[model samples]
Target: MRTLAYSLDVRFKPLFEVMGSLHAYICRKSHKKLDLSPSWAQQVQQRITPELSDLLDGIGIDGDWKLTYLLVHLCPGEDAADFVEWLKGMAAGDLYELMSPYSNLFPAHMGDFRDRTVRLFQQWNEQYMQHVDPEIIERLHVEAMKRKQALPASDPFAFVDETTNGLQFAPMNELKQIILMPQYHFQPINVVSYFGKVTLCHYAARIYLGDEDFLTPHEYRMIRSVAEKSRLKILKYLRQGPRSFIEIVRHMELSKGITHDHISKLRNAGLLTAHFEGETLTAYSLRTGALEQIHSKIMGYIEQGMA
Candidate 1:
């Protein structure tokens, strides 16, 4: 099947990193077993001033995180301070016009949203995002830029899937543009959203630094993904062929949340392939090729140690 062509925009946005980290930090309850756990979020929260905590917590209420993520893209600055100031300078009508196309719900008061969101991001910058390692930021930016250069001659669907570990986000509706952005905080899961005519994909950036202790190794994660009894069963079932997420859930007889978690681990490790049917995950399959590479992967690691 052929994919419709869309204008591809790939770049690293500093605002995305700030928004991504905050979304992960604030929504830690639903993200247990993730690379950064709820415990890590709690530890970080303890260091935050009470006032800032109160302000940021509002973002987690009723999908306000969407507003934060959408709002930040309006700021093109590389620094958080500048991004905050850009938001502060936005006129109410201008802000409304900018956001209207994407959502119908506004904060109870637009005036309050204009003031509060800016202040929250400003303090968020001072208290946390500033401490983010500069090296990781640079690496994500470089990788996004490199992908942008290569995208012109590549199959758009295949490129999106490869960049996001089997997220085949096909073009649909009136969507005419796709932004492929690299993200760090939300590891192991790709975040996809829409606004007006643009589709934004914050693909997980597997940024590993320092030692090779398997902190975020592909081979180790791939091996660890199937270590659990439930995961093995799930894979065995998937070996039959592609099945929608619900079929696996019914067959496993586990809670929906538990089933999704197990599937996520397999997807993250590249042991499974997932495809979207118009923005909804409609199919998942065991990647036999990935299974085949497991042997070579371990051998490659062994070869690395030998060298």
Candidate 2:
């Protein structure tokens, strides 16, 4: 058993190294920029590294995936077939679809690692930019900046300063959210989507709102701590109209155990409202008025930040 565990760890060594470095990078950044706390570490791990780890797991079989990544470190090339075949021989065939070009457009189970890896290589090579084509990078940077400008000044979903700043990283959160979606789109370049327009729009809202660095330091931390990628869907549903506990559970298709805990937290925070429909319990109308006003204000903050 010990040997097996050791071998498995060895097989995943490359993955561990990359993720460990990236995790440290984010932690350092968060610490310097965002008052990194224990909670912040948890958030970064949950929102960032683990997502990448899952992707690595999906694409890897035994050591092949890890080997391919390591080879990239050693050889740095476009083609990954030899490494892919080597990994394939060791593990199940499930990850082939994820590795195939056809599925590259859709969201890979990897989440931000695609970007993170790109960033990592750039760090490794110390260049003007990394990963993406220069033209594409310029285009995306422009588009991201432009999108940052166009976000509404006052959205209908914001609650307080915490919620406002919470919206900052929500796009990354949405990427994580989409990763879990049964119909998630994986376009390697494009960040938009097709299936489930409502769900997509909910994601779109976060993109539109973009970054929010205007909040005070403490406020930003509070927001970041509360609003997570996993909660984005729940926030979306709340936006349309609040639902009863039962309704949210039904709509989200989450387990009762999970939904109950999340709902309790949201309600405690005043982001959601819960009540009774006859003998049964209910909630209604996503946050509006104050929440809406706050949401919009943060959106405006995002625009200004982009500018």
Off by over 4 Å in 1: 1-5, 37-39, 213-216, 277-279, 302-307
Q: What is the TM-score of each candidate against the true structure?
A: 0.88, 0.25
Q: Any residue pairs clashing in model 1, and if so which?
A: none
Cα miss at 43, model 1 (Å)? 3.9
Judging by TM-score against the true structure, name the best candidate. Answer: 1
**lDDT of candidates 1 onward, in order:** 0.78, 0.35
Query: Tens digits of per-residue lDDT for model 2 on 18-136?
Result: 33233333334333332223354454345444544453334422233332333333332332333333333332233344344212333333434344344343332222112313443
lDDT of 1: 0.78
Per-residue lDDT tens digits of candidate 1, residues 103-195?
776677777787887788788888898888888788888889889898888887667767877676555676778788898888766777767
Clashes of 1: 0
Q: Residue 191 error for model 1, in Å?
A: 1.7
